[model samples]
Target chain A: MKLTIQNLTYSINDTVIVSDVGLNIKKGEFVGLIGPNGCGKSTLLKNIYRVLSPDAGSIYLDETDIRTMKSKELARKMSVMIQENNVEFDMNVLDMVLLGRYAHKKMLGNMTPEDYEIARKALEEVGMAEYEERSFLSLSGGEKQRILIARVLAQQTDFIILDEPTNHLDIQYQFQIMDILKSQDATVFSSVHDLNIAGYYCDRIIVMKKGRIIHCGAPEEVLTSQIIDELYHIRSEIRENKYTGRKQVYYIPNSANISTCAVTENL
Target chain B: MAAAGFAAMIAAMLLGSVGIQPDWVVKILANHLSRHNIFSPEWEANKEAIIWTLRAPRVVMAYVTGAGLSLCGILMQALTKNSLADPYVLGISSGASSGAVAVICYGWFRFAGAYHIMFGATLGAILAIVIAMKVSSVSNKVTATQLVLAGIAVQAMFSAITNAILYSSTTTSDKLRSAMHWMVGSLASASWNTTVYVLIISLVCTVIIRLFHTELDVLMLGDDTASTLGINLRQVKIGVIVLCTALTGSIVSIGGVIGFVGLLVPHITRSIVGSAHKRLIPASVLTGGFFVVICDMLARILAAPEELPIGVITSFFGAPFFLFLIRKSRNSFGGKNG
Candidate 1:
C-alpha cells in the first residue's frame, strides 16, 4: 500500500507545529522520521494516523483519502504503537492482544478460532507467547513494548506507524523490536530518537526541523554532518567505519569545538 | 437461570410470614389467578390476610427492587469506569427521597395516591441526574472524581431539603416514619400490580442493557479508545445513563433508597466472571436477583412479624463484604501503582 502525506499543516492555537510536511512511502519500505525535540515529528505522525487532523492537505492510503475513511477501517489497514499507554485495570496479556482484533471483528461478534491463531502467532513472533496468561501490568517496560508490538502484529495491518516505540527500552529490546518490524516486510514508518538505531534500521530517512522537512533521502544521503548541524545546531562528523564497513556518525560537545575546524571535520 | 431465580423467589414466598402452607400458597396463587379473592377461603383467616396482603407483596417487592438496583449498579459501574460508582452516585435516590418527603409531609396522599409518590420520586431522580450531568460536563471529560464529587454535593443539598421539610411539617411524625420506611428500603408494599410493574420495567431494561453489553465493554476502556473502535462515545454514554437512571428511578419509586446492592454486586460479578461484560452482565442480574431474594428472606425470618427493612439486611450483609472486596481488589490491582 502506498502512503502519501500531502502538504500537511498543523497548528495548535497560533503556533504552527507541523508546516507543509509531506512524504510518499512506497509499499513494504522501512522509513524513519528523525528530528530534534520540539521539531513536530510526533505531531506529523499523529496527523497521518488521524489522531490529530491537519489544518490543511491530506493523507492517502493509495487512492483512499484517510480523513474520509472510517476510523475502524483505517485501523484495520494501519496499526499504531504510540508512546504513553497506561492501564489502570489489570487485563491478562492475551486478552490485551486480542483487543487488537477488535477493529476486524463486528461489535457483537465473537472471536473465531482463526483470530486466536493469528494472535498466538503474533505473540510467538515477539517471543511473548508464554506470557499470554500473565497480567499485563506485571511486564517490564521493554517486555511491555514487545507485547504492544505483538498486539499490532495481530492487528494484521500491512502498514505500521510507531511513535518512539523504543522510548524506554534497553539497547537489546530496541534492536529486537526494530528487527521484528524489519522482518515483517511491512511498510514501517517510525519516529526514532537514537541516530545509530535510525542509521542501522531505516532504509530511508526524513529529517524535520521546526515542523518542516529539512532533508529526505536514503539514510546515507540524509545523515550528512551539515544537515545534522542545521537540524540540531550541533557540530558532528559522519564517516564509514573501516572494520565494520558501516556508516558511523558521532557528535562533539560544544566545549571541544575548535575555531579552525571545518564543519564536517570537527568531530 | 431466570427459571431458577423465579423458582427460588417462589420457594421464598413459602418460607415467610404467618403459617401459609406450601400447598395453600400454591392454591392461593392458582385460585387468585382464576379470579377468586383467595381471602374468601374457609382456610385459616389470619393466615389468608397475612399471606395475601403482607408477605407476598413484600417478597415480590424485595425481588423487584433487588434486581433493579443490582442491574443499575452494574450498568453505572461500566458507564463511569469507576468501581465506586452506583445509581445513587448520581444523587438520584436523594432527589427521590426529597420528592417523597414532600408528598408525605404535605399530605398530598389524599389526592396523589401512589401516583404522587412514584411521580415525585421519579421526578426527583431525574432532576438529580440532570444536575450530575451538568456538573460533570463543565469539562468535556467526566472524570470519576468529578462525578463522585458532584453526586456528593447534590446528595447533600437534597438531604438538607428533605430535612428542612421534615422539621417544619405539622405531620412530621407520620411523614418521618413513612420516609424512614422508604429510606430504610422495603418490599412491604409489594402487590400483584406492583410486582407486574417492576417485572416489566426491570425485565425490559435488563434485556435492553444486555443487548448493548459489548458496547458497554468498549466504553469502559475510556472514550478515545471506544471512539477508535467505531463506537460513538457521546451517544452511547448518554443512552446508557438514561437507561440506568430510568431503572434507578423505577426502583426508587417503589423501594426507596436501597444502598450498596448496586455498588457491591458488579464487583462480585467481575471477580466471578472476569471483566467481560457479556458474561458479567447476565451474571450480575441473576446474582443480584438471588442476593435480594436471600436478603429479603432473611429480613422476613430474622425478625418475623416486625419485618426488618430490606436495606438494613443488604447493608448488614453488604457492608462487611464491601470492605473485604475492596481489600481483595486492592491486592489484585497491586495498590496505588495504577
Candidate 2:
C-alpha cells in the first residue's frame, strides 16, 4: 500500500503543531521519521493513522481519500502501534492479540479456528508463543512491546505506522524489534529517536524540524552534519563504521557550558 | 453456576417469614402456571398469596436487578477504562434517589402514580450522564481520568441535593421512613409487573452489549488503540453510557441504590474468566444474580419480623471481599506497585 500525504497541517488551539507537510511512501518501503522532540513527528504520523484530523490537508491510501473512508476500511489497509502501554484491565496475551482481528470478525461471531491460527502465528513471529497464556501486565516492558508488535502483525495490514515502538526497550530488544520490522514485507512508517537505528534500517529518512520537512532521501544523502546540527542544535559528526559499513552519528559535547540561546544562535 | 443461581432463587422464595413448605410452594406455583389445582385442594389462601404474590416476585426482581446492575458495571468499567467504575459511580444512583425523593416527599409528578418514581429516576439518570459527559469532554476527546473525576463531582453534587430535599421536607414520619427505606435499597416493593419490566430490560440490554464484546475488549486497550483497530471510540463510548444509564436507572427505580454488586461482581468474574467480555459478561451476570439472591435472602432471614435493607447486606459482604481482592491483586486495578 502507498501512503500519500499532501500539505498536511495540524494546529492545536491556534498553534500550528504540524505545518504543511508533503510526503509519498512507496509500497513495501521502510521509511523513518526523525526529528527533535516536539517537532511534530508523532503529530504528523497521528494525522496519517487517523488519530488526529489534519486541519487543511488530505491523506490518501492508494486512491482512496482517508478522511472519507470508513474507519474499518482504513484499518483493514493500515495498522498502528502507538507508544501507550497502560491497559486498564488484566487481559491475557492471547486475548489481546486476538483483538487485532476485530475489524475482520463479524459483530456477533466467535473467533474461528483460522483467527486463532493467525494469532498463534503472529505470536510465534514475535517469539512470544509461550507467553500467550501469561498475563499481559506481568510482562517486562520489552516483552510487552514485542507482544504489541505481534498484535499489529495479527491485524495483517499492508501498511503499519509505529510511533516510537521501541521506546522503553533495551539495546538487544530494540535491535530485535527493528529486525522483525525489517523482515516484514510491508510498508512501514516509524518515528525513531535513535538516528543509528533509523540509518541502519530505513530505506529512506524524512527529517522534520518545527513541523516542516527539512530533508528527505536515503540515509547517506539526507543525514549530513549541517542538517543534524540545524535540526537538533547540537554539534554532531556522521561517519561510516568500518565494521558494519552503516552511518553512525557521534555527538560532540561543548568544552565549556553554553547557554541555550548561544547554542540556538550557533545553529 | 446457573443451577446454583436457580437453587438460590428457589430457597429465597421458600425461606421467608411465612415459611410455606416446599411441597405447598411448588403446588402453588404449579397451580398458578397451569391455572388449576392438581395436588392439594385444601391449600390455604394466605399461603398461596404469600408464595404467589409476594416472595416469588421479589426473588425474580432480585435476580433481574442483580443481573442488570452488574452488566452496567462491566460496561461502565470498560467504557471509562477504569476498574473502579460502577453503576453508581457516575452519580446515577444519587440522581435517581433525588428524583424518587422529590416525587415521594414533594408530590412531584403526582398523576403518574405507580410509574411516577420510575419516570423521575430514569430522567434524572439520563440528565446526570449527560452532565458528566459534557463536563469531562475536552475538545472532542474524553480521557478516562477526566470522566472518572467528572462522575465523582456529579455524584457528590447530586447526593448533597438529595440530602437537602430530605432535610427540608415537611412530610410525616411515615413518608420519611418509606423514602429512607427506599434510599437504603429494598426489594420489599417488588411486584410481578416490576419484575417483568426489569427482566425484559435486562435481557435486551445484555443481548445488545454482548454483540459488542469484541469492541469492548479493544476498548480496554485504550481509546487510541481502539480507534486504530477500527472501533469508533466516541460512538462506542456513547452507546455504552446510554445503555448502562438505562439499565442502572431502571434498577435504581425499583431497588433503590443497591450498591457494590455492580462494582464487585465484574471483578470476581474477570478473575475467574479473564478480561474478555465474551466470557466476562455472561459469568458476571450469573454470579451477580446469585450473589444478590443470596444477600436478599439473608436480609429477610437475618432480622426475623422486620426486613433488613438489601443494600446493607451487600455492603457488609461486598466491602470486605472487595478489600481482599484489592490486597490480593493491587496491580489488577492499575494501582502502582509499592
Candidate 3:
C-alpha cells in the first residue's frame, strides 16, 4: 500500500528531465507534489504511473518492483486520473464509466449488476447520478473532471494518483474535487497548482525544484514564504486565517526579491 | 434479423426479370443440390441453366460481397477510430482500380485467367496498405489522422497514374468501358466458384472480429488506457489492419470498388445500439450483410437487362443517408464535418 521511488532518472535526448528523484507515499496518507511550472512534477508522476519509464531507477509498490507486475495486476492495485483526457467519441456517461470495469470483468462475460452498482455508486458520489444518460461530450469542464474521477473510483483500487485533477475547474468545484479526494480512504497522491489546496489536503508535501526534491516535510515546514519565493521567484506574504488559524499564501505580483528556481531542469 | 436478411434475399431473387416460376427455380436448385431430379423433367431441363448457372451464382456473389464489404467497413472504423475510415479510406480501392485497369488495357488474359484482373486488384490493394502503413508509422505511434492523410495521398497518386495509362493506351474503347465498369464495382462477373471462397473468408473474418470485440472496445479509449488495461495496442492495431485489408481487398478484387458501406454501416449500427463493441460489431456485421444484399438486389432489378454497378447503388443510398445522419447528429461526433 506504499509507493517508493529511489534515485529515479529519465532523460530525453540526453537532457535530464528528472534526475535522482526520490519520494514515498505511505499507506492511507495523502501526499502532494508541488513545484513551479515545468518543474518535473508531471514527469516524475508519469514515471511512477508507468506512462513513462525512468532511464535509471526503481519504483517499488510495497515489496515488489512495479516494473515486474503485469499491467492488469497493477491496474487492479492502483488507478490514475490524468489531465489531458479529451475524447472524440460521443460515449454515454454510463458507458464511459463502465469502461473502468473493463479490467475487472472477463473479456467474454456479460456485465453483471454488481458492475452497474459500482458505476452507479461512483457516479452518485460525484453528484453525477442524474447525468448518467447524458452524452459525455456535452458536460462542462468540472463535470467532465468529476466523471473522470468517477471512472477512477469505479476502478476500485487501493491507491489513486491524480495529475492536476482540477486544472480547469472554478473555485467551488475545485474545493469539491479536492474534498472528495481528501475523503477517500485510499492512499492519494496528487500534483497541484494551488499550494493552499495542497496544504489543506496533503498529509505531507514534496516540493521539487529543477527535477529534484528541494523540500519534503509537513506543509507548514516546506511552504514557508522564503521557500515559496525561492522556488517560484515571486514574493508572497504568508499569514494564518483569523478564525481557523490555517496558513495561507498571498503573493505580491512582480516582486523583485524572489529568485525563481528553474527546478524543472533536473527533471 | 438473420431470418429477415434471408427473406429479403429470397424476395430479391424472386422479383427479378423473366419472372421464373418459383417451382422451376426450386426444381433447378434441387436438381443441382441433389445431383438428381425428382421433379417434372420439362421444367427442370429448361430452367436449370438459367437459374443454377447464371442468376443464382451472381445473387450469392452479391450477398457475399455486400456482407464482406460491410464487415470490412465496421472493422476499419473501429481500427482507425474514425467513422469516415473505410477500405477506401486507406486508398486500397484506388490502388485496386489502377491494377484492374492495367490488366484490362494490357489484355493480361492471354497470360492470366479472366479472374487475373481480381488477383491483380488484390495485389494492388495489399501494396497500397503496406505503403500507407510504412509512410504513416513515424516513431512508435500511428495516428489515425496521419493514416487517413497518407491514404488520401496514395489514392490521388494511383488515380493519376491510372488516368495517364488510360490516355496513352491504344486499347479499344470497349476495353476502356469495361475497365470503367469494374471501377464502379460489380457482382456481374461473380460465379459459383467465387461465392464459396468469399462466403468462407467473410464469415470467418466476421467471427474473429466479433470474438475480439472486448479488445476493440478498449482500443476506443486510446492507446495509453488500452495499454494500462494490459492490452498491447500496437499488436492489436496491426492485427486489425491486416484482417481489414485482406477481407476488403479480396472483396474489392472481385466486386470492384464499392465505397461507403464501411463508413455508413457502423454509423447506423452505433445509432441503433450504443458504442459498446460487443453489440456494435455483431450488429454492424449483420446489418452490413443485410444492407449489401438489398443493394445488390437493387442493382440487379433497377436496370433490368443491363446490370448497374453495386457501388452506384450503395452511393445512391449511402450518400443521402450520410447527409441525413450528419444533419440529424449535428451536435454529435459526426458533426465535425462542418
Candidate 4:
C-alpha cells in the first residue's frame, strides 16, 4: 500500500525536532531516509509508526488517515521495528515471533496451528528457524536483530518501517539485514546511515537536515557529491559502483569538512 | 501448589499458640462447612473453637493476603515493565495503610458503611501509585533502581501520613492499637466478615489479571512493541492500576501492610515455571498462600502467645532478598546507571 504524510511537525519542550515535513512512498517501493546524526530521521519514522504522534501534521497509509485508526488496526496495515530496547524478561524465540499474530487473534483467542506455521516461516526467512526454542535474550546482537525482523515478517503487513535497523552490526551482517529488508514484498521506509547501502537498496532516498525533508528522488539523482556535501557537511565522492552501475558514495572525511546548513544543530 | 497451599493452611491451623489435634482440625472444618457435625467430636470442646471459630478464618486471611500480594506484585511488574515493582516495595501498601488509617482515625467514609475502609484504601493505593510512578518515571522508562528508590520515597511519605493520622486524631488507646494493626499487618483481627470481603475482592482482581496473561507477556516486550502488537496500552495499564489498587485497598483495610510476599513469591515461582503467566499466575498464587501461611505460623509460634506483625516476618525474608535482587540486576539496564 502507498504511504503519505502532510505537514507533520513534532517538537520537544518548544523546540521543533521535525518541522512541517511531508513525503510519500508509493506501493512496494523501498524508500530510505538518510541524514546526519540527530537530524530527526528516527523521529519522523516514529511518527509514521505511531510511536510518537506528530505535533501538527498528518500521516496517511493510502487514503486512511493514521490518526483515525485504532492502534491494532493501524498495526495490521503497517509494522514497525525500532532500535532494540532491553527487555526485562525472556521468552522462547518462537513465542516472541508469534506476537505478530496478536492483531489477527481475538482478545481471548488461542493461537491456532496456522499462527505457529506463520511464525516458523518467518523464522525460516530470517535464518532463525533452528533457534525457535532458544531464549530470546541469549542471541547475539546481530542474531537478535534478525529474529526481530522475523517478528516483522510474521506480522505480514504490506507496509513496514525500520529505524536504523543495522546501527551496530558488522559490515557483512549490515548488508545481510539490508538484503533481507530489500527482498520483502512491502512498501518499506527505513532510516539508513550508510550512504552506499542506501544507494544499493533504496528505490528513492529522502534526505533530511534539522528535522525537515530537504530532498527526495531516485538514489542516482539524489546522491550527487553536491547533495552529499549539502546534507552531511563533510566531503564525499559519488561514483558508479563497479558491479551494479548504481550510485555509490565513498567518504573522504578529511576533505572539505565544513558546515553550510546555516544552523548550529546538535549532531 | 494448590494442594500444598491447602496442606499449609491446615498445618497452620494445627500449629498456632495451642496445638489442636489434626483429626479434630479436620472435624472442626468439616462440621463448619457442612453446617453439621460431619464426624463425632472426639476432642476437647475448646479445641473446636480454636480450630474452627478462630484459627481457620485467620489462616484463610493469611492465604488470601499472601495470594493478593503476589498478584499485586505480578501486576505491578507488568505495569511498570520492571521486575522489581511490587506493592509493598513501591509503597502502595503504605499508601493503602494511610487510607485505612484515615478511615479508622476519623471513621471517614462511614457513608459506605462496612466497605468504607476498602474505598479509602483504594484511593490511597491509587495516590501512592501516581506518586511513585511520577517520581520513578523521570525517564520514560522505569528502571530497576529508579522504581525501588521511588517506592522507598512513596513508602516513607505514606508511612509518615499514616503515623500522623494515628498520632493526631486518635483520642483513645484502643483506636491507636487497632490502627497499628493496619500499619504492621496482622490477621489477628481477621474474622469471617472481613475475610469474606477480602477474599471476594482479591478473587475478582486475580481473575481479571489472569485473563490478561497474554497481554502481560506482550507488555514485557515494552510499550512500543506492545502497542504495535494490538495491545491497547492505555486501557491495559489502566485496568492493571485499577485492579491493583482495589486489591491492595481491601487487603490493607483488613490485614494491614503485608510486605514483600508479592515480590518474593512471584520471583521464586517464575524461576520454576519460567515467564509464561498462564503457569506463573496460578503457581505463584498458590505458592504465595503457602509462603504466607508458613510465615504466619512462624510469626505465631516464634513469639508464642504474643504474635509478631506479619510484616515483620515477611520483611525479614523480603528486605534482604530485595537488596540481593538490586545487586544482581544493577547492570541489567545500563544506560541509566554508571
The clash tally of candidate 1 reads 1
Model 1, TM vs. native: 0.79
Q: Compute DockQ for each candidate against the true complex.
A: 0.26, 0.62, 0.30, 0.56
**What is the number of residue pairs that collide in model 2?**
0
lDDT for each residue of candidate 1 in A1-267, tens digit (9 for 90 to 100): 879988999999989999998889999989999999999998898788776789998899988998788767887888888753534445577776777787788755777888899889999999999999887768999988888888889888888989988987899999999999899968999999988788888889999999999888888898878888888877777878676565778777688755426655544
**Per-residue lDDT tens digits of candidate 2, residues B2-32?**
9999989888889966767777777777888
Better of 1 and 3 by TM-score: 3
Identify the superior model by TM-score, candidate 2 or candidate 4.
Answer: 4
TM-score of 2: 0.91
Please count the clashing residue pairs in each candidate, in the order shown.
1, 0, 9, 0
Please tell me the TM-score of chain B in candidate 4 relative to the true structure's chain B: 0.95
Candidate 4, TM-score vs. the true structure?
Answer: 0.94
Query: Who is ahead in DockQ, 1 or 3?
Result: 3
Note the chain A TM-score of all models in turn. Answer: 0.94, 0.94, 0.93, 0.93
Badly placed stretches (over 4 Å) of model 4 are A255-267, B332-338
- The C-alpha stretches of model 1 lying farther than 4 A from their native spots are A6-21, A36-46, A51-57, A83-85, A208-214, A224-267, B1-17, B20-57, B95-144, B161-171, B181-184, B297-308, B312-338
lDDT of 4 by residue, B1-338 (tens): 88888999999999966667787888789888999877988988888877876889899999999999999999888878777899999999999999988987788889999999889999999999999988887557777767888898999999999988887877677666765687778888888888998999888888887887888888878888888777888888888899899999999988899999988999998888767677789998999989999988988989878888888999999989988888888785455441
As a whole number from 0 to 100, the lDDT of residue A104 in candidate 3 is 84
The residue-by-residue lDDT of candidate 3 on B1-338, one tens digit each, is 67777666666656666667766766666777888876756654545676777777776777677667766766666655556556765677777777767776677644657567666666677777777768755553445556657877987887776676676784567556655655677777777787767777778888888888777777776666666655656678877876776676567767777767877887877878877777787777778777888888888878888778888988887778766654554543333322
Q: After aligning candidate 3 to the native by TM-score, how far in Å is the CA of B42 from where it should be?
A: 8.3
Indicate the residue-level lDDT of B72 in model 2.
85
Model 2 residue runs over 4 Å out of place are A255-267, B34-38, B100-116, B136-149, B163-170, B319-338
DockQ: which is higher, 1 or 2? 2
